[model samples]
Target: MKSFDVAIIGSGPSGASAAFELSKSGISTVIIEKETLPRYKTCGGGLVFRGLKMMPFDISSVVEKEFYAIDTYFSQKHPCITTRRKEPIVSMVMRDAFDNLIVEKARNNGVTLLQNHKVVDITFGETQTIHTTEGDVTAKFIIAADGALSPIAKIAGWKETRTIIPALEYEVEVPAADFERLSNDARFDIDAIPYGYGWCFPKKNHLSIGVAVVIKTNKKINLKEYYAAYLKRLGITEILKEEGHGFVIPVAPRTDFFVQKNVFLTGDSAGLADPLVAEGISNSILSGIQAAEAIIESQLDPEKAAVLYTEKLKTGILPEIEKAKVLSYHFYSKKSFRNIILMKYGQYAAEALTDLFMGERTYPKDYLKSITKKIKDAIFF
Candidate 1:
């Protein structure tokens, strides 16, 4: 078995970010990926500005579209809110290219890349030994960033109650004329459907259109049906290419155990996804960096490292996720009220809501009170 200072499983954004951060600190690191380079991942491929700021390197090369406006619709007929941001709020990119770019950066930074290697089993003793398809490898520390269904997390006996949000996304090519007319100036639109919402994220040549709905509900609405309806609403008929893919996004935070002995879990494996938007990429990257930092700190002082990891989650990420869960419950429970609030508040509220969604600001009790006031004002006024 090959031994190293750190062993990272999975090559997604989280894993790659951890590998890069550790390797750059001169720690011997190895990354094991289950798939080949440039693997396709089922995702909406949207990157918020705050997420981009957390990366160690520049990613301008991988950005597909820079959107500064958001158009939200409560129903298919009318727009609820149209907000123009002063700065670039979000960027859209294909996951294959985006993840591959980060992995390549990690390789360039001297992290050993074990491509096409799947980690089957992991044993923690004096050191950690991971059994992979290629071979077994040993490391002083192991970081599990293998996503929602993380095997490493399972082996470590980390308990998680994941709220899976089923999403079906597609990339469809529209005629040049229609694309030009229908597409706003680098803006993304969100249309609230019966069970969930539909979104349109424009790329270089095609549009990333999708719908997401909560799986726990009894509403068995087909996403493709919504997609067709969305297209018809937009007056988009001609399509060059269309491909639909579905993936599960965890909405709630994991219970408690994200770290065990010599193992640490980051990203979706720890259920760090944003509950309000179901966005995981930024949170995954942030958690990975935090995990790497915790590992390094733990190496210096083991007890302090463990304490710091827990503290980081409690003070850093968990609070935001907790607030998001409440917001998500509110949206899904009383969607009409949420829609009316968006319509009445318009862009200022949208921007603040966007900040809340991106985890840039904490949701205070007063903010919720203000929302209630707004609802009352809308009713009375």
Candidate 2:
């Protein structure tokens, strides 16, 4: 068995990032990935500016497109709001290349990359033994950076407490004119689906389009029907090539403990996706870095690292998600009232969202109080 100080599962942004940080600090790290490098990942591929800025090295090589403005559309009654910025608001990329780039960086820094190694089971002990199909590898700590359906989390005695929402995405290619027309700007259509929103993210060659319902309901929502309607709304007459993928997004954190024994959970494994937008890349990278830092700061003391990691999450990631939950509820649940508020102050809200995307702002600590005040002011004054 090969032994290391830390073993990280998955090769997405979270795992790659943790490996990169840990290897930079001279910690023995191994990234155990089930697939080969540059495997296609199902996602919108819209990397917000905030997440883009988290990259330590330049990723221009893999970036497909960068948009300086974002167009948001609601019902026809409410006008579309365009938010602009000096810097690009969102940069698009295919996840296969983007994720592989990060993992390569870590590998260059001496992190072992174990491709085609699927973790089938985990044996907990002083040194955790990760049993993969290929073989067994041991480590002092295990960082589960695997995605929403994290088997490691379940093996570590965690229950399903995260709010998992369904989403459908398609990689679509159209005529030159349609691609050129829609490729210039990133767009979002709120209320495109019941309790959800739609996004059209232009890539280098095709358009990555999708719709996701934030809040789960008892009603059976047909995403395909809505997707077809959305395509018509976009004026898309012909589709040269289209591939659809269905996946789930974990928008809330698990109520269970983050660390058990020496195994630590990060990113989707810990259910750290942004509650409002379902954007997990930024927080995934952040949580990965935080976990690495906690381990480093504690000098490899598992107990101390666990406490420090939880503290770091509470201070930053958790609170932001909580506030985002409040915002998402208000924005999606009360549709009529939300439209009213947007009709009055849509531009400001769009600008605020752009600022957040640019990493210049954060979700306010007391979002409910602020929202109430705004509602009162909007209604009376």
Candidate 3:
């Protein structure tokens, strides 16, 4: 059995980031990827400037476009709010190229990548056993960065609690003229789907369009139909491929468990994606870094590593997620509350959200307290 200091499942941003940090520290690491490298990843391909700033190395070659403003729309078309800043807010890149670039960097840092290796099963004991199509490999530590419906988490019985929601994305290769004509800088259409949002993110040559539905709302949704309606709203009559891909995204951080015995959950496995924007790549990279840091700090003690991970996670990603959950709750659950507030202060909220995306502002711990204070001081006073 092949053994290593650490084994990472899934070679996306989280796993690759972990490998990069661990290998840089001289800890042997292996990344097990089910598919060959550079395969198409189902994402809107919108990376906020914060994620771009967090990367240790440059990925300029993979960046397709950068936007200084993001246009956000309400259920109606006319009263849209545009979040603008002097610096670029979001950078767009195809996930295949972007993820491959990160993997290459991790490889350069001495991480071994086992491509086309599907993990069939995993067994936990003194050392963790990863059963793959290639062979069984053992590692002292396992980083389950394996996406929303993580098989590793299922095998390990980490937690049944997660705010897993359905999202669909389509990379439509429109004609060059239509692509140019229809592509906006960055746009998010709220209420594109009930209790969720639709987005139109421009790539270099194509446009990535998608809709997400919040599952906790208990609303039965047809994502494909919503996507078609969105295309119509955008006046997209011609498309090279109407094919769409569906995947699950975690909106809230897992409050249940981050570790089971020797396994550490990062990324979607840990449910660490941002609750507000549903952005995983940024926090996924952050979780990967903290996971490696915890392992290194704990001196490989599973219990101590678990403690360190939880503590760091609280200080790391949970606060933002909590605030986002507040936003989600108000926006989706309480119904008309979101509309009332957005109607009154949509521009301010849009600007704040843009700054939040750019890492300029952090969401207050108690969103209602802070925001209400601001509203009262400004309006009532």
Q: Give each model's whole-structure lDDT.
A: 0.78, 0.91, 0.85
Candidate 3 per-residue lDDT over residues 1-381, each given as its tens digit: 789989999888898888898987888899999999899989988889888888999888999998898989876733878877887799998889999999999998889999889999988888999999999989989999888889988888865687888999988888777788767678898888888889999888788899988536665889999999998988888888665899989887677778886888999888887876788889888899899999888877888988998899888688778778877777766656566666667888888889888888898767787666655555665
TM-score of 2: 0.98
* lDDT of candidate 2 over 198-288, digit per residue (tens): 9999999999999999876788999999999999988899999999999999998989789997888999899898887888998899999
- Candidate 3's C-alpha lDDT? 0.85
Which stretches of candidate 1 lie above 4 Å from their native place? 77-80, 185-191, 300-303, 357-360
The per-prediction CA RMSD against the true structure, in angstroms, equals 2.2, 1.1, 1.9
**Which pairs clash in the backbone of model 3?**
none
Between prediction 1 and prediction 2, which has the larger lDDT? 2
Between prediction 1 and prediction 2, the one with superior TM-score is 2
List model 1 lDDT by residue over 1-381, tens digit each: 788888989888999898888876888899988899898887878888778878778888989888777666655444556655555677888888998888889889899988888888887786888888899999878888998778787788876677777788888888899778756643334444454677778888888888787435676777778778878777788888899887778777778667776777889888888876777998899888888888777673445666777788888889888876777777666767776776677666667766754446766646678889999998899
Q: How well does model 1 score by local distance difference test? A: 0.78
Error of 3 at 30 (Å): 0.5
- Candidate with the greatest lDDT versus the true structure: 2
Clashes of each: 0, 0, 0
